[model samples]
Target: MNAPTTPSTALDKHTGEPLRPTDGQLALAEAVRNGETRETHGTQTVPASRYTDPAHFEAEKRALFDRLPQVLCPSALLPEPGMAVPHDQTGRPLLITRDKQGEAHVFLNVCQHRGTRLVEGEDVQCSSKLVCPYHAWTYQLDGRLLALPRADTFPGLDKAQYGLKELPSCEAGGLIWFSPQADADFSLAETLGEDFSAFAMEQSFLFRRRTHTVKGNWKLIMDAFLESYHVLRLHANTIGPFFKDGITAGDTVGPHMRSAVGRLEEVEGVDFTDMAALRRVITFAYQLLPATVIVPSPDYVNVMVLMPQAHDLTLVEDFMLIPEAPATDKARDHWERSWALLDGGVFGSEDFRAAELGQQGLESGAVDHITLGTLEGGIKRFDETVQEYLRAVN
Candidate 1:
């Protein structure tokens, strides 16, 4: 017998070649090589239009959400046949189920007749068919039209042609991704690029989740996560002291970014050796393009993905994942402590507060344009990507 060959390691089969870094990315990389650091105070601010313009928001829906390969829903949540999940933001019912042969199928959750929504919850198990509640329209697990209540009442009804509408979907990183538009030519790996696969995301699991409605543009929420410059002032009592001065950041294309906060040796009571050990206790944070932030701490991993609802409202979901099994209670306890600290200190406090303020400022028309300085390389790259995506769609 031949040993199984590993999956192909070439540039993603769909994208043609490895993605190139954007000009903003190249400049950030060069700055990193020169040992440039973040400034204590930002001199440039992002333009308010980036957060407040309705045209820009519509463009984002087309270029970023419709065209990108993002993991909008998790696959594990729909493991069984007959499961249905509703995406309230998109007003599309998402149906997940297995065929008679047990292959997974995903389709838009709407009945072909009169467009009534078919499914209503996170997950549901069905034995053979999904019966629509509105008029008893039934569909097979494979999405073929199974039955109609009044077949003879309607003439020229084509059962073969009236099946459930299907969406383009692919599963990766343990999540189900579907494109809202049918004709989009983007592939998941191609849109995210080859470098994203380097994060070893499959090794992680979900451990904690918090979702909330915030009064802010989703971009404002994302901006809160991209840079650590505010750590010294806003998070001073929490994560500030742990992060040393001289923090640096770099950017990559496809809108992906990387930033690092230094842990120096000169802090008054903190020991570098101990801090290095603690740094291993938490994975470094890396921001995926558009809306996901993944933090791989030594003891646990945390991720946040923001979905936009309206220009002024957003849905933010956060998840914490730890190793499936810890060797000892002490090890498990250590992770628990780290999770609590992060939850209360960062996510629960300063992070959301700053976004709330930024949201209010945009709403109040207090500023028309916010600037981006050399210190905010990550934010600069993010703004540029937003602009490019807007232009691509518009």
Candidate 2:
């Protein structure tokens, strides 16, 4: 903890309503008050094996990816009553369209007759019913079999039994989440708490998308975003000037966590009473458990999702969701230039480069453990939460 940067209050600006920071953020602020910012969680470390073990990775796939509820995409992707899109990670497809009463439903994209994919390609699709290209087996938006081609050829066939497999899904905080298994621990309101509304999730729409196929363990890539300690060094030429080094608050929400750090020059003195000033001084990151990270910025939200491919390989999709459309060509050009900085700078060359090298060292069996300082508490908490989840899974 460090000395108090500013006196604390819990009130919003306009409404004077209560404002709550995540547990992690509050701890960090309190730590700063007590003069423990740089050294609070110092001297903590985890076994290096956790990062390199193939068995552990396999367990993660089963315990976390297969069992828990993870984000499929933003709920805004399929807004219209007949919108459908393929699940990028699974390539198995997902059908999300509303019924007559305007209720959303999700179902498998496979035809029951011959396991043919119902929809193909990348782009939002629209149709009241999905018809398989292979056999013309059709299904309604609600996942009920509407018709099967050549019905008389197949006698004693039950349309109800062959309806597309309905996966248990949840939409809260404006995200579509589901699991491979029959059950999942899912509650959008609970997972994100009040921050769900704070994120303005309903108003957001996908603005940009890019994928990075990197050679590194997924956890290694995630650890890069867990703390602000490296911002001054790795991002020195880029975001380094924008953020304070080793000043952050981390809060754990169930199996997930949130971290917020002050802007570099603004940390020494802050005016918590001025909401605009307060916001200008800090940035927030929501680590959505296993595979997603959402960072809420002033203009847009940054979402990073990792699709694990192997023990030391992962596919990362970075999505930027903005609430408003660009009104003019200049606004559009501004975003284009900003994305160039982002895609090629922070997450691009610097972060992924580090991820690749980190895996090499961890896999070399050279270090027994990775030591973490008090300032690196975010990483410690994140690793612990992950291990906790893995241990509890059955």
- How far off is residue 306 in model 1, in Å? 1.5
Please name the candidate that would achieve the greatest TM-score relative to the true structure: 2
The TM-score between candidate 2 and the true structure equals 0.84
| Model 1 Cα lDDT, one tens digit per residue, 305-394 | 678877777777766665344567875666566666776557766687678778788778877987665555567667777778777767
Model 2 gets an lDDT of 0.70
Tens-digit lDDT string for candidate 2 (1-394): 1111222443443465644444444455555434454435338888887778888888988877877777777666776677677665643466665655555666777788888878887677778888889888888888889998789998999888988888877777667777767856676435574564445565566778888888998888888888777888998887787664436666667777766676445555664434334444566787877888877654556778888887799888787766556778976776666666666677889988899999999888889999887667777777888888888985
TM-score of each: 0.72, 0.84
How far in Å is the alpha carbon of 314 misplaced in model 1?
A: 0.7
Q: Give the poorly placed runs of model 1, Cα more than 4 Å off.
A: 1-43, 79-82, 96-106, 123-129, 140-142, 146-159, 185-200, 260-283, 325-345
Lowest lDDT block of 10, candidate 2: 1-10
> Which prediction has the highest lDDT against the true structure?
2
